[model samples]
Target: MLGSLVDNVVDMFQASNVDWKKIIIVGAIFDFGFKTVLDVLQYRSQCRASPPAEITKTGLIDQTTFIKSQNYSKSKLRFGMFERTISLFQNIAFLKYNLLPKIWEYSKVTAATYFHGGDIVAGIVTMLIIGAGSTVVGLPLDWYHTFVMEKKFGFNKQTFKLWVVDNIKSWVLALILTPPLLAAILMIINYFGKMFVFYLVLFMLVLNVLAMIIYPTIIAPIFNKYEPLEDGELKTAIENLAASQSFPLGRIYVVDGSTRSTHSNAYFIGLPWYKQIVLYDTLISENTSDEIVAVLSHELGHWKRNHIPFLLASGLLNAGLNFAFLGLFLDNASFFSSLGFNAGDMPTVVALLVFSDALGPLTAILQLVQNLIVRSCEYDADRFSVRLGYGENLKTALVNLNKSNLSSVDADRLYSTFYHSHPILPERLRAINEEMDVKKSAEKKRQ
Candidate 1:
């Protein structure tokens, strides 16, 4: 049975003809150029908008703060351009030289000599080596962004020691988790043949669920401290809001977000039974209790509207499609050979990298669609918060959050459509105000 399958796979490869080299080069150029143009256009748009002379209805910043924010945005744009330029050159060089296959060749030989297993073991070792190499190469950029840029903006709180420790912990965790997962994938392919796509999708679904469950409990605590939210009016307000909304109330915990950066955020972790709401300590210090409750109300709105499940379903659909295409390419030995790999000599990890690159354009289009959905969801959630009679408070929270995070309040429509997963600060504020006005008008009529 295995022999017949192998023969069939080889035959399929022999009959196939695809210009992988041309496809990769075109995709790389298109993605690089498109993103670079968008970045420049967005930056220009921000620069053209003058800071309000006084604080406006949208909570426009004072001139000093506005100037600082502009500078911060410019610095980030410059850094992103530098990073992307480096990445584009790196990717082109890697593809042109077929470095992945070379790395795989070296890894397989080393694995056979030192390790006591088959292709799966060697593939895992190869993937780890590649991952480690990439991480080391990118470390300087990450360090500069964290210690230099963020520090200059007064957002960074991470010491060099903490940064190093965090990276090491991340590496250790990846090592512990990745090999088994990769092995399972390889085993599925070996056993399931064409049906591997279906099984792989199943594996990914299971992995996603497990990650959601594990992240807040086992993984997150490795980096930051999490303590139950103190007995306070904030906690009482949050509980009351959740109760009023019929939202599942969970144990509220505060994360030491200021340990790494002054940027504030709030999110929930775990499924229904084991859920917890995590508020950044920075957020607590920066905003009022009502604003905090308003933010939580927005989050609860996501749950109430079933956005999570919808997102998950969308992701699963994408995964299924991706896995199906990947299985086809992996089985096609000619595809590997065209990229300087020997026919039938491709590793699973290498195949994944190549396949993802080949599908880059398609993936980008899908991402744009996903962003539209996400932005719509954001609007819906904002309306939900307003319906809870916290529209003004939520608006205040959004303004403060944007200011604290140094986020640009406005961007070009095209840029926002392509990149933003939520409406810009001004748009969100307008929506909230409109909702509030409608509510007030209805109340006056009733009176």
Candidate 2:
């Protein structure tokens, strides 16, 4: 009779059960599989034949040599060590408790209890752990990459002091903002449960709007000084063209772009009160005002077409998907509690971090989609520029800029598809020529 009762109890538990041990095993397997695959693919892709000659064909030291001169040994060593440590620890955990089925089963039962209790402090604590860990491990690697390697390549203009100051300021910014935001998100998760997706999507859209409004006026000035375009004929020409196009451009600003790096490009940074077009001094030194105007016109095209709003809408949709995925993990308390999380323990925040880390490949896919839209918008903006003034001038400016920087005219299609935000120079030039031919034909018919 006792043996029969015990067997019945086991059957009942098996019928309605959440096994947490299986989950841990799965996480370990996923981590190992992802890291191995990514590492192998990245190594295979990077190991190309002799460095492209175009990079060094210029009289200056080749970009390849400059890049190689920078010491990445420390970063490589750090990454390898980190990966090994994670793998080792996970293996140890698995070995110590071969009874994943039982532990995981218990973790699921306790998940709800932990969720009920975790609070804001829990979120903040997690943030500090992650922030500090990233700082200690990631910062030095970046320092070596930028200051040591990029400087050797003649790309970095920032002094060590400047770099240190920037890092401190960045950390301060994170400290000020991230904890509260994360805590608030955790609070939201508490009430909404899986329904947190809608709120999260709204929040992302609002954030992007806020950024568009405030960045040029406030956030940008912290990193670089800005002044109105100097009193010159170039300024007059741009203003005149703006008036002709009914472009609501009030001012053009020049930024001290060289303070941080040698790479140069111009961009429009904000909305309305903060709406300003910024030109890089490097651009000023390289191109005529006519060419600069053509560039500015392209930026204006983005604004005129409401591309920013479109981007924001797309971003919100993407955020919705992310929060939905997060909801799946958050609803199951066992999933997180197993990973050292608790309910009153800020489970949402902790779970979020882990979910985000797990979702890296998905994030990459979304980024690729965003880049595709941006590249398409760029071509439209280029067409707008040609309609407003000079396509040839823009092309000339592009050619000079590409040659000066040793920009890769051609790229491996797969690489460009994966990594490039903008289309390659050859593609851009070809598009411009096609537009110009259409324009010329239109003008002849009108005559």
lDDT computed for candidate 2: 0.66
- Candidate 1: lDDT of 425? 79
Residue ranges of candidate 1 with Cα displaced over 4 Å? 1-16, 51-55
lDDT of 1 by residue, 1-447 (tens): 998997785566445577676777789888889998999988887695564322265554766677678889889989998998988888889888988888888878878888867788888988888788789888999999999999999999999999999999999999999899888988887889889888888888898899898898899999999999989799889888878867677789999999999999999878865568999999999999999999989998888898888888888877787776677677666677777888668677777777877778777877888888888899999988898888988988887888899887667888888989888877887778788898889889999
lDDT of 2 by residue, 97-158 (tens): 53223333343444435644234564565466556765786676678767775676567899
TM-score of each: 0.93, 0.75
Worst 10 residues of 1 by lDDT: 51-60
Off by over 4 Å in 2: 1-118, 337-346, 359-361, 404-406
Pairs clashing within candidate 1? none
Candidate 2 clashes: the total is 12
